[model samples]
Target: MSGVITGERRSADTHSARSGGGAFVPEATPLDDARAQLAVATGLLGYSDGLHAMLATPRRELTVAVPLRADDGSTMLFTGYRVQHNFSRGPAKGGLRYSPGVNLDEVRALAMWMTWKCALLDVPYGGAKGGVAIDPRLHSKAELERVTRRYTSEILPIIGPERDIPAPDVGTDEQTMAWMMDTYSVNTGYTVPGIVTGKPISLGGSQGRASATSRGVTHIALAALKHRGISASRASAAVQGFGKVGRDTARFLHQAGLRVLGISDQYGAIHNAGGLDIERLCAFVDETGTVMGFPGAEPLDRDLLLELDVDLLVPAAVEGVLHEGNATRVTAPVIVEGANGPTSPAAARIFADRGQLVVPDILANAGGVIVSYFEWVQANQAYWWNAAEVEAKLEERMLSAWQQVVDYATQRTLSLRTAATVLAVERVAEAHRLRGLYP
Candidate 1:
C-alpha cells in the first residue's frame, strides 16, 4: 500500500510541469481524494497491504480517440476513456459522462466510487465509468449523436449487458444512452437494451429511471434533516448545480417542503430568500437555457451560492466545488452531496470537525445505480416494473442503506463516509477472498 501511494505521488509530480524541475503542481484531483477515503476505510478494516493495493487500483482501463465530422465538414478529435475499477462483486456498472473536463483520472475516481456505492447498497455489481472529453452543449444534435456512436463503437468490445453497463451522467442523458444502445446493437446484429440503463422508456428503460438520482438524493436529504432535527417545512436548501441531478433535486426538495432558496448552473445562480419557485425556475431554464435572469429570483454570484446560510446545502454540481477555501464559509448545518466527490478531503475533515452532518455522495446518490440495477433486471427478465413499484423499491433500499450506515457510524464513531466505505470495502474484500485469484 505504501509503495502504491508513493507511486501515485510520483505520478502526480511527473504530470506537473510548473516547477523549475518541470513540475506543475496540480490541485488535488478526485482520484487523490478517492484514494484517501479508501485508505481510511482499509485502515479501519485492518486489511493487508496487498488487499489495500488491489482496492486502490483499477482492474482495467481503455483510452480511445474519438474523431468527429461537424455539420460544416470540419474535423475534430476528442479523447475518450472507460475504466472498470473493480468487478469482484459482480459486473461493472457506472455512467457515461460527456463533458469538456472529462479525463482518465476523473473517470477512474468515479468508477472506484461506483464500486463502493454498489457494494454498500448491496447491488450485485462492481464499478465502472466512461467519458468522452467533448462538451455536449457545444455540439449539435447530429454532432452529439455521431460522437456518442463513435465513442461507443470504439469501446464496444469491452462493454455489454453482462459485462459493463453505462448509463447517463454529467453532460449525457437518456438520448445519449439510446445512441450507445443503438450503436452496440447494430454491431451485434440485435437489440441489447440491457447494455445500458437510463434509456428512453419505449426502449426498456425502467419507469422511474430518469429521476432516480434526484429522488434518491431527496430521500436521503429528508432523512438527514430529520436526523439533525430539522423539519422539511422549516428547512431551507441551496442546490449548486442545475443539470440532470441538480434540476430535479431542487424540484423534488421543493416538492417535499424544503424552501429551495437558491439554484445555479454553470452560467450563473439565482436566489430568493423567500424560496424560489422551482417549477417556474425550471420552466425559465427550459425557455432560456439557464437559471440566471429568472423573474422570481435575484441574480447571485455562482460561487456565493455555496456559502449561503441555508439549513441544508446540496452541491449537485461538479467535483471539488466545496473545497478547503469554501468549506468553512459554507453555513449549511447539513449537506447532502448530490454530486460525486463534491466535497474534498480537506473539506470533509473540516465538516467532521465542525460536527456537520454531511451525507456522502455514494449513499446520497446511489438511487440512480439502484434503479439502474432494477432496469437491468427488468431488461434481463423482459418484464418491466411500474413507476410506483420502482419508486417503492428504491426508497426501501435507500432508507435501509441509510440506517445501516448511520448505525455503523454511531457504533464505530466514524463519519458516514468512513462507515459506508468501510462496510463496502469489507463486503468487496470478502467477496474477493471467497472467489480466490484466477489461476
Candidate 2:
C-alpha cells in the first residue's frame, strides 16, 4: 500500500503541468485524504495491518493513451485512466470526468470514495472511476465524441453492464455516456444501454437519474434541519458552485422552503439578503451562461458564499473548497456536501470543534447511485419505472441510510463522517472475509 501510494503521488506530480490556458490550481491531496479516511475506519474496526493494506490498495487500474484525429486533419494525444478501487461487494461503479486537472491520484481517491458510498447505501456495487486529462470546454462536439469513443475502446476490456460501469461527472454529461454506450455496442454488435447510467431517457436511462444527487442532498439537508429543530420555511442557505449539482441543489432547496440567499458559479457569485428567486435565476443562467449578473441579486466574492450567515451551506462544485483557511469563518450550522471531498480533514475537524453538523458526501449524495442501480435493474429486466416510483424509492433509501448513520453517530459519540466510513468499511471487510482468499 505504501509503494502504491508513493507511485500515485509521483505520477500526479510528473503530470502536474498546466494544460492550455488553465492555471495550476493547488488543492489538497485527495489520495492522502482517502488514505487518512481509511486509516480512521481501520482503527475503529481493529483490523490487522494486512487487512488494512488490502483495503487501502486498488483492485485494478489501467492507464491508456487516447489518440484523437482533430477536425483539421491533425492528431492529438491525451492520457486517460480507469481505477477499480474495490469489487468485493459487486461490480464497480463510478463516473468518468474530463478536466485539465484530471490525474491518477484524483481518480483513485474518487474510486475509493465510491466504494464507501455504495456500502453506506448498500447499493451492491463497488467503486471505480475513470478520467481523461483534457478540458471538454476547449473541444468541439466531434472532438469530444472521438475522445470518448477512443477512451472507451482503450479500456473496453474492463467495462460492461455487469463488470465496471461508468457515468457522467464534471465535464461529461448524457451525450458523453451516449457516445460510450454506442461505441461499446458497435464493437459488440448490439446495443448495451446498461453499459452506463445518466444516458438519454430514451436509451434506457432512469426518469429521475439526472437530478438524483441534488434531490438526495435536499432530503438529507431537510433531515439535518429537522434534527436541529429548524423549520425549512424559516431556514436560509448559500450554495457554492452553480453547476450541475449546485444549480439543481439551489432550486430544490428553494422548493423545500429555504430562502437561498446566495449562489455562486465559476464566473462569480450573487447574493440577496431577502432571498433571490431561484426560478428566474436558473433561467438567467441558462440564457447568460452564469449567475454573475442575475437581475435579482448583487455580486460578491465567490469565497464569501461560504461565510454567509445562513442555516445551511452547500459546496457542490469542487474539492478542497472548505479547507483550514476559511473553515473557521463558516457560519452555517449544517453543511450538506454535494461534492466529493469538499471538506478537507482539517476543515472537518474545525467544524466538529465548533459543533457544526457536517454531513459526509457519501451519505448525502447517494441518490444518483441508488437510481443508477434501479436503472441497471430495469435494463436487465426489460422494464422501466416511472418518475414518481423512482423518486419515492430514492427518498426511502436515502432516508433509511441517513437514519442509520445518525443513530450510529449518536450511539458512539462519533462524527457523521467517521460513523458512515466505519459502517461502510466494516461491511466491505465482512464481505471480503466471507469470500475468503481466492487464488
Candidate 3:
C-alpha cells in the first residue's frame, strides 16, 4: 500500500532449526527494535494489555545442542534455536541462518518479523526462525553438511511440512535447504520436499525462488517511484550488501531502467555515476567473490554507499547497518529494506522526521516468503509452475500488498511502516480472537 497520514508516533523493538545446547543470552538490538515496532502497532489497535502480551510472546521455542565432528576428527558444540512466534494464522514459516552471532533473542526477533511478514502478505503461515551459532565460512562443505544434518535431526520434533517449514536466510543458501530437506526426509523414512523451500529445482523448489526477494524489492521500489511521480529511467539507486538479495536487487533495478550507481559487498563498494553494468559486475563478483575491484566502477567506502545521493537505497546485507549513527546521513528518498531488521528504531524515526518514505522490511522483503508459500503449495500438489507464471504471480501479489499498505497509510495518516505493522497485527489478532484461548 502507498498514501500517508499526518500524525502518528511510535516506538521500536524488533528462528530455526536443525540440531542443540543452551546458555542464557540477553536480548539484542534488533529484538529491541522488533518489540518497539510491535508496541506501536498494538497501541494503535487499542489491544488490551493481555492481548499485547500474548502477541509479543512466542508461541513456542526450542533450544538444542548441536554437536559436529570436524573434518580433522575434532568435535565442536554449537547452540541452535527454533522459535515459533505465533501460529494463529497457520504453520510457522521462516529461514534458517548460520552465523557466528546467532542467538535466541535474534531468533525471537526474526520469528516475530516473519509472523508479521507472512500476515502482511496474507500467506497461510505464521512466523518462525532457526539459527545455529556457528560460522559457516569457517567450516568446510563436509563439516557444514554434518552441522546441517545434525541440527535438522536435533529439531526434527518441532519442524515439519504441516508444522514449521524452513527456507534459506543469511549465511545459508539453497544447498543448506537441500541438506535440511534430506535430513528431514531421512528421518521420516520418505521424501518430503514440502519440509523446506529454496531447495534445488530438481528437488521441488519453486521457479524464481532465488530471486524472489530482489524481485519483490524491485517491484516495491518501482511502485514507490511511481508514487512519487518519478520514472524508473530517471531514478538512481544504491544497494548495500551485494549478497543474495542485494545482488539481484541491483541487477533488477538496472534492468528496470534505474541507474544503479553504487553497489557493495562485505569487503567494499563500487560506484559509477553513469550507472554500473550489473551483468558485468555480477560476473566480476562471481569470478572474484566480491565487488571490491569491478573494473567499470571506482572504489568507494562501504559505509558511504548508504549515504549516496540516490532515489532508492536498499540495505540487503545484515541487521543494524542503518542504525542511529548513519541514519541521519542517508539521502535516499525511498528505502526498500531487503534485509531483516536493517533499520534500528532510532534510525527509522530519523527517516520519519526527514520525511523519507521508509518501506519497512516486513512489507518490502516479503516476496521471499510469498514465493516460499507458492513453493510449498506446489510441492504438496506436485505441480510445478513455469518461470513466467511464477514471476507474473509474484509481481501481481507484491503490487497488491503494496497498494493495500499504501491505501491503509493514506487513509489512517500513518507511516508506511506503522500502517503495514498495524494491518498485520490486526489480522493476527483477529485470527487469535476468533480461535480463542483454551483453558
Candidate 4:
C-alpha cells in the first residue's frame, strides 16, 4: 500500500522558555498554548532562537466590537476577534467560531495551529482564526444572521479571496458562511465565493467540505488501526462530541465496519456495548438538539466518555478533553484528535508512556483546510470542481499526509504528535529563512 514515510519526526518539546515568573505558562488557551507549542517544536526542530522567538508569536490580531440588534427589542454588544497567525507562506485561512469562551488567546492558538496544519499538508496557506464571545445557540437565526453579517463587515478590511478567509468553527455553518460571502460580495459589488468556504453548495461551496474534518478524522483512525495490525472491522470506537465533526465521524466509521460504542454532545453521552446506531443517533440529535434522549443507548456523564473502553477514541468536540486530570484514566489505545489542542503536551506524553498512539489535530483534522484551499483555488479561477473530484482530492491529500506522519514517527521513534509538529515546524522555518524578514 506504499506505506513508506516522508521523513523523521521533529521532536517538539516541553515549554522551557521563561514567562513572567520563569514558570511554564500552562497550555490552557489556544494562543498561550500555541506559543508554547511552537517553543517546544522549535527546540526539537533546531530553529535559531531568534527565529523561535519570532515564530512564537502571531503576526497580527484585530478585535472588533460587534453591536448586534437582537430579535427582541434590545441591543446587545458582543466582542469579536480575528487573529492572523502567520502569512509568510500565503494568505491567512481559518474558521470563525462563536462561544461564550471565545477569546484572543484561543483565537491565537487556533491560528497558530492553522500554520502547522497548512505546512503539514504542504498546502499553500498560513494560519488564521476568528471568534466571538456569544452563546450562539441562545439566539434565533435572524439574530445570528445579523451578527454574522455585521461581524463580516467589521473584518472586511482584512478579508477577501486574496487576503484572509473564514469558515465554520464551533457554532458556525454553511449558512453563516453564506452570510459572510453575501456580505463581502455586497461590499465589493460582486459575488466572491472564495472569501469563505464551508458555505451552502448552491453558493459555490465544495460538496464534501462540511464533513471534511470528520472524514479526515476517520481516515486517520483507520490508518492508526491498520498500522497497529488491528482490523477496523473488529475495532471498537468512542467519540467525545456530537457536533458536525463528531456526528459525521461516527457515521463514517460505522459505515466502515468499526463498532461505535459511545458518543457525547454538550448535553450528555450515550453508550452501548455492540454499537450505537449512528444514523439513528444522528437523527435523534437532529430532532432533540442533543444525544441525551436516544432510544437504544444508556447515558453516561460527559466527562466519562474519555475513559471508555475502546480501540480508538476520537475527541471531536472542545479543546483540553485529554488533560493532566484525565490523561491517566484514558483507556483507548489510540486517540485521533478532531479538535485543536485536544490533548495537552504533557498529557500526550503520558499517553505515549502508556503505549498509546495519538494523531494530533494538525494532521488528523486537516481535511477542512485542504478543501478550503480547493475552494480558494476555485474562487480565484472562477471555476469549480464537482463533488466527486473534491472528495477524491480530499481523500488523496489526507491519506498521503497520514502516511507521511506515520512514516516520520516510525523512523524517529517518536509519537505521531511530535513527528507532525517537527515536520510542520521544519517546513515553516525553511519558508521563513527563504523569504527573510523585511525591513
Candidate 5:
C-alpha cells in the first residue's frame, strides 16, 4: 500500500503545493525536478510505468512534531521529516539536515537523489533523508542539541545502523550526529556507534570523513576540467557557497592549482581576479565567521558570483541555485555540482543547448557517502582504517565512478546526468526485479 502513488498522482500532489507567498509558482520544485529526471532515465531504460512508479514513490515517509525547550523557558514546535525513497539494493542511508526551508518535498527529492548517489558509487544503501524545519543559525548550541535529540527520538522507530543511517547535511554536522547517537543509544540501553556517521573521531568516526565531500568534488572538478582541455593551473573557479561543502571544496580546488577567484557564504560573496589566498581567507573566516570583509578580496554581488566568467563554477550551496532565471547568464564552461540538485531541469536544458558541460551532483559530490559507507563498515567491524588508507579508497571509488559515467555518457550520446541516473536506476530496477514483489 505504501508505494501505490502513481506517476500522475505524484505529479498532481507536487504541483498543488504553494509557496509561502500564496503564489502557485509555476516553476519546477526540487521534487518535480527529481521526478522529471527519473522519468527520463526510466524512459531510456525501457522501464514500464509500474516499475517507474515503484521507483518514483518513496517506500516510507514519516513526519513528526519536534518540540524544543528553549534556554529562556519557552517551548517552540518544529516539524521534521524522514523519507526513505528506496530499499531494493540495501539499507536506507542519508543525511539529517536542519534549516528553515526544510520541508517534506525537499527531503523527498534529496532522499531520491541519495538513492542514485549510492547506486552510482556502488555503495550498499538505498536513498533516505531526514530534516527538521528549524534554522541552526538562530539557535544556541544547547537548543540545537535539544532539537536534534527530540527529532531523533521522534524518528527512532525507523532509524538504525542496518535500517536507516543518518549523516550530516546542510545545517547539521558531527556534533548533531553525536547527540542523535547518544539519544538512540540511551533509548536502546546500549551503545550504537553505527547508528549515525560524521561523528567526532573519538566516537569511531572514520578519518578523512569531514572533508570527504569536498575532496570528491575537487577530484571530479579537476577531471572535468581536464576532459574539457582546461589545465588546473590555468583554470579559474567560483564557488558559490562557503558553508560545509563549499568552504572545503574551494580549499581543495585551490590546493590542486586552480585559481579560485570567487567564494561566497550566506552573508556575501568576495572576489579576487588574481585569485584569492584561500588559506588566508579560511583563517579570516575562522576569526570573523564570514567571507565578507576579508582583506584579500573585494566584495562581489552574491548573484553575480554565479555568473562569473570563470573556467569552473562549483555551486556547492543549496538546491536550485542554477535555475531558469539565471541559467543563461552563467558563463562558466564547466560546472561541477557540490550541492545536491543545484541545477534544475530547465537550467540543464539551457546548459545543454549552450554546450556547457555539467558534472551532475550524484557523480560529482558522492565522496561523503562513499566515506560514510567506509565509516559504517569500520564501526560494524570494530576496526578502523587510517586516514591515508581511507582517502586512498575514497579517491579510487570516486575516480572509478567518474570514469564509468564519462564512458557511458560518451557511448550513448547522453548527458552525464542522464547517463548517471540511467546507470543508477538500472541497477536499482535490476535489484528490485531480482528480489521481486511481496504479497
Candidate 6:
C-alpha cells in the first residue's frame, strides 16, 4: 500500500497542477476582482458607493501555514486560507479546495460569490470559502489524507457546526469532506455532522450533493432554452469543462434527449456531429481522469471547441474562458454558465448585445449550495432525505428562481446574467439593510 502510494505521488513532478500565477500579488489578490464584480454590480443596481464598498470585501480571512510530513520524509509547507465573504444571514458555508492555484484572491472572490449564491437561493447560510495551495494530483491517498487532516486542523479555530462549515470544491470531494468532518469531530470529542456538507452518505452527506450543481445547471439550461424558444430536444449543445459540473450537466442534458455535440476538459476535447455517448465518456473520465482519448470521438483543439456552432454553450470549468477574444465568436443563442465567472462582463455584454441569453453563475450554479443547504439541514435535524425528495425540492427551487430572474429580465429588458446579479446583490443588500450596520 505504501509503495502504491509513493508511485502515485510521483505524478505531480510533471507539473500538470500548476495554479496559474496566484503568487504574483502578495497582498490584495485576484479575489479583489470578485470585489470589483460586486462594485460593478452595485453600480448596475444603483447602490451607493459606500454600501457597495462594504459588500466588496470579505469580513474575515484566516491565513494558516499548513506543514505536512510527506511519506518521502520531506517536510512541505502549504499556504491555506479561509475567507468569509459575509455572515449576515446565518453561518458561513462553502467548499474547501486543494489546488496549486489556491490563493487569497481566488478564495475571496469565491467566498463573495458564495455569500450572494446563498442569499439568492434564500438559504439560511452566509458565504465562506477556503483552499490550500498544493497539487493533490501528485500525492497518494494517504498523502492526500494527511494533507487534508493537517489543513483542517490549521483552520480548526474558525470552523464549527454553528460557525463556518466547509465542504468539497475544486480538487476535493466527499472523501475530503469526510476527513474534514472527522477532524472536527475528533477534536470536539463527538460527532457533529452539521460542521460540514458534502460528506459521504454514511456520514450524513445529502443524497444528490455530488450532482447537485450539474442538475441545477441542467435545469437552468432547460429554462434558458425554453425562454429563447429553442427546443431542448432539437438543440445542439457544447459543454466546456467536463469535470463535476460539466459531465453531470451533459449527462442530464443527454438524458433529456439533447444532442451534445462537443465536450472538453483540461486535457482535451472530443467531438461528434450527432451526439457523444456521455455514459461511456463519464466512465472513461473516471478511469483515465479526463475525456481526451475516448474512442469513437475525434479530438479538437480546446479553444476551437468553444467556437463550434451550437444552439447552447455551457462553460462548466474555470472562470474567464469567455472573454473579449472569444465572446464574439460564441455561436450559441443560449450561454449557461455552469462555472463561476466563466463569462466576463465585457464578453457577457457581447453575447447580450448579440441577443444571446446567459444564465449567470449565481443562478445557474446555485444547485450545489442548495443541496449543501439540504445536507446541512438534514445534519442538524438528524434525518436524511431520499434522492427523490432532494431532487424534487431542488427542481422546485431552481424553477422558482428561474422564473424570478426571467420576469425581472423581461420587465426591465435586461440580460439574464445582469438580472441575476442584480437580483442577488439586491437580496443581499436588503438583508444587510434589515440587519443594519453594526458600529
Model 1, runs deviating above 4 Å? 1-26
Q: How many backbone clashes does candidate 5 have?
A: 0
Over 1-439, each residue of candidate 5 has an lDDT whose tens digit, in order, gives 0111111212221233234454444567789999999999999999999999999999999999888788888778888899999999899999998877778998999999999999999999999999887777878999899989999999999999989999999889999999999999999999999999999999999999999999999999999999999999989999989988999999999999989999988888999999999999999999999999999699998878999999999999888777766778899999999999889898899999999999999999999999999999999999999999999999999999999999999999999999999999999999999998996
Native-vs-model 1 lDDT? 0.90
Which stretches of candidate 2 lie above 4 Å from their native place?
1-27
Q: What RMSD value applies to candidate 5?
A: 5.6
Score candidate 5 by lDDT. Answer: 0.91
Q: How far is candidate 3 from the true structure (C-alpha RMSD, Å)?
A: 8.6
Q: TM-score for each prediction? A: 0.94, 0.94, 0.93, 0.92, 0.94, 0.92
Which lDDT tens digits does candidate 6 get at residues 346-374?
67678878888888888999999999999
The local lDDT score (0 to 100) that residue 91 gets in candidate 6 is 89
List the global CA lDDT of all models: 0.90, 0.89, 0.89, 0.84, 0.91, 0.83
Model 3: which ten-residue window has the lowest total lDDT? 9-18
Candidate 2 TM-score versus the reference = 0.94
- All candidates: CA RMSD in angstroms? 6.0, 5.4, 8.6, 8.5, 5.6, 5.0
lDDT of 3 at 388: 96
- Candidate no. 3 TM-score: 0.93
In what order do the candidates fall by lDDT, top score first?
Answer: 5, 1, 2, 3, 4, 6
lDDT of 3 by residue, 263-330 (tens): 98878889999999999999988999998878979999877888999999999987777766667789
TM-score (C-alpha, index-matched) for candidate 4: 0.92
Candidate 4, residues 316-402: lDDT per residue as tens digits? 987766766567889899889988888877688789889988889999999999988888788788788988998899989999999
Candidate 1, position 157, lDDT: 87
